[model samples]
Target: MAALEISKATRRIASTYPSLVLFQLARFFLVLATEMQAVAVGWQVYEITKRPLDLGLVGLAQFLPGIFLFLVSGHAADRYPRRTLLVLCYCGFTLCSGSLLFLTLRGLHSVYPIFAVTVLLGVVRSFNGPVSRAFLPQLVSGKDFQTAVAWYSIFIQSAVILGPSLGGLVYAAFRGPAAVYTLSFIAAALGAMSTVAIKAQSNPRLGEPMSWKTMLAGFHYIRSERLILGSISLDLFAVLLGGAVALLPVYAREILKTGPWGLGILRSAPAAGAATMAALIAHKPLGHRTGSTMLWCVAGFGAATIVFGLSRSLTISLIALLLVGATDMVSVIVRQLFIQVSTPDEMRGRVNAVDMIFVGASNELGQFESGLTAHWFGIVPAVVLGGLGTLAVTALWSWYFPELRKTEKLHSPAP
Candidate 1:
């Protein structure tokens, strides 16, 4: 009887598990693939051009279109079927991968075409971000959203850690860029398939016209949300200045004195740390005094960034990066939970777009800053200075968002 009951439970879970859950997992794999590809691309471009500025330009190329199209992307997400939109977005990304695969296969060493592809990918990502964010609520109830989101973060960070490490290893082992591109294309194709299989009940809006006016409303609403603005700003500035991921290649080659395997370890350290912490948070939500927690997490992240920048030993650097990832994960969970709980279903898409813009700007823009600063002060000093800047930004934000500092409770009821 017990064995029969166990089997029955397994069958029930299999039958009831939302397809969106699987879709999210597949999305994670593609993100992992993309991050891995990015490391390959950045390293390849830097090797060819021998210019730090070239690395910064790669991020700039992606961010330029992202900023221009983000608002419209959000509006479209709000007005359309999110699952279909996500499928289309993955399709576009796959095409970008196809182009890169072609270039690598043909031994094209020119940097311009790579930069162009990066920009094109960014354009597609702008739409993709909003759609993915808005699609989540349709899969689960509000009470489960927090838990679900925590799992989502785990998937994302895990991929981020795994992808670059794998990419570095695969590139080094194969000694050819084509293999990396091929892997990326395969992952992207899988992501599209996952997206296609995602099930959702769509409320189709009939004959709703899109306009700049609706887009402006999203911007206006975002401006009025203090917690949302504060949380996003904290992450933006802190990550922008404290970002150390972009400097991995330099660290791997120079300070670390290790090969591609070492590079993978350095890259994966933070994600590993984040995944561990995310698992803990999923079981126990950060209750009450969330605001103060966010501040301290950002502070810890900044401190870790400084330590990472200053560390000459690979062990020390890995430890510092791990701390940074763990701390940053706390801030991320807080912000995402706050945003999802506060946002009405009608506004989720545009609000998500606003959030994505802030996220994209901080990361890619931070990479540009790191690359440019590295060019000027050399890599170590540049990373150190960025860490200090992050600390300063955290201090300033503490005073600026008093309400956020005092936010003591989130009112989600039991499912």
Candidate 2:
């Protein structure tokens, strides 16, 4: 039944937009390698410093590049061939992965080298993220775009589910991260090739000269659109506080008394949950109460986070994290669909850049916030506090953006 459903979905996508298959392939390798590299990095970094702050620093290093280059990168996506830019970014990823391998081979006494390379990877992502997101809408027809986005997430979640497990297997077999890093490099290089194979034509423009007005267009547009503002900002704050991913290493090592293999399972649980949500969304499109659904889901995400924070048992923790991913997926799909449909193609690069920035800040910067709070307040307290913060943000956002709260249906993309 699962295979048949996927086959039907593939045929539908192929009939409307053939290139999306290749697009999904590119994303698969890219996400798989990235997640594997992440597991390696987390383990290696924690092994070196044994400090939660350094772990947070790792996230901050990657996030800062997106913060400083957000507008410029977005502009480049609009000004350059997005596909070409993406290819370059993948090459950069390959280099970064290789650098990690080199650093691992050399024997590390400090985490500075790890942090430095992560900054480089972050720079690549700053450009790649917005371009990749904006490029997705062009991969499918307008009517099927929402469904495509949901399925798109399925591919991502699939990688999320597998990457850590593979990373752990390799890491345990080798007793180090060097082999994992090598695999990451190989995957990234393949991602570049898959992208080069994409035959779809992207209409990136070079005619628009760089100006303050042109650069700021995405920011201006988002600010003026109240619904857009609410959706993005709500996600920004909700996940910003609700996220517990950065602290997984700490959980596995300290509280859970588990090693890298256990950490891998912990990391993958959320993705496993996300996969369930995406599959459901793909099979049955969201109902009329999408706006209310989104709000409720975010609230559920926070509640789940709290449960995970308070739990000492691995079984309960995994269940909590699963709920966390499931609830978060609902809001994310709704937000992505609404944002993509309402924004014009010409402005997609810029708009999605801003959106990507918010996302990065919520995840990476949120890591820094989590680490600092953990250092100050202790790990369990930090996580519990973040969950509470997410709940508070949800309440405030619901009241502040009734536009998002009362939303009836997602918008259809402009053809």
Candidate 3:
């Protein structure tokens, strides 16, 4: 009887939350396509200029649009039908991949055209990031939302794991990026289709008049909530300093004595670790001391970065990168849960928009920072110093953000 019941429960899971399945599918394909494009661009850019600063410029192009558009993007998410917005965003991504494929196929002499296309890609992502995050709360109810967050994280990490490796393999096998971009275009189109299939009940809109005040509400709310502010800011600074991913292309070419395929594997290492951790958290949520756990995990992330920077062996480097992703997942899960659970449904879009800036800065801007430092200080010192800086930031944030340090629960409303 127990065996029969277990089989019945497993079957029910397949039929449940069909919309959630589509949401995850959309998330997976879009991210997969993006990651594939990223690897190709990084290699292509470095190959053209043979300079680290240009790599930094690539990141800057992607990041600057978000800084300029965050206010408008957040507002659009709240005012527009989110499902429609997502479909449009995915379409934008498909178009971006098509643009890259055309550029690659035409034979590139300079990196300027690639940079121009990346800037266009960045503009689309600014809107997509906030709306995608804001859409999740509506798709899953309050009771299941935390698990949904974990599962969605798994979707993201799984793509990160596969995208670069597959991109790298395709690039090497075909002797260029044309095949990779072609695949990315197809995947992004599928992402659009998947998002179109989702029929989630949209979040209710307040129909508030547009104003600077309304647009900036997300900033004010985050500021007033110390826990939210501290957690988000903590990640912004920590990952900004600790992130060494921008240097992977260089490492694969010069330092590691490898090529594009090796770079792909290195790129996927962190995500591989993150997916494993997310799957565990989905099965069993962190039950206590969420804030403190985050603090410790970030510190671990810093230490891991330091190890990755100093290591010369490929095996050791992969392990260090794995630890980097694993430790960072704790912060990712905690910060996401805090923001989603604490904010009301109406305000989620805008707040997540503000949060996107913080997180995006940590990622794209962080890549730019890494590349700049590598240009100025040489690769090893840049990475090692950044890792050490992350440790110092963690120590100080723990001291300054008493509210964050004292917080014990992951799911509680922020008061």
User: Model-by-model lDDT, in order?
Assistant: 0.81, 0.87, 0.86
lDDT of 3 by residue, 281-353 (tens): 7766787788898999999999999998998888999999988988899889889888987887677779999
TM-score for predicted model 3 compared with the true structure: 0.88
Q: For residues 32-95, could you state the per-residue lDDT of candidate 2 as single tens digits? A: 9999999899999999889967866887788889889989888887888878888898899999
Which candidate number has the best lDDT? 2
The weakest ten consecutive residues by lDDT in model 3 span 5-14
- Preferred candidate (lDDT higher): 1 or 2: 2
**RMSD for each model, in Å, please?**
4.3, 2.8, 3.6
Query: Tens digits of per-residue lDDT for model 1 on 112-183?
Result: 989989999989988988888778767766555666676788789878878877887888899866788889
* Residue-level lDDT for 60 in candidate 2: 79
Question: Any runs in candidate 1 off by more than 4 Å, and if so which?
Answer: 1-16, 43-53, 106-111, 203-208, 247-262, 310-312, 368-388, 412-415
Question: Which sequence of candidate numbers ranks them by TM-score, best first?
Answer: 2, 3, 1
TM-score each candidate. Answer: 0.86, 0.89, 0.88
Whose TM-score is higher: candidate 2's or candidate 3's? 2
- In candidate 2, position 261 carries an lDDT of 73
Higher-ranked by lDDT: 2 or 3: 2
Clash-forming residue pairs, model 2:
none
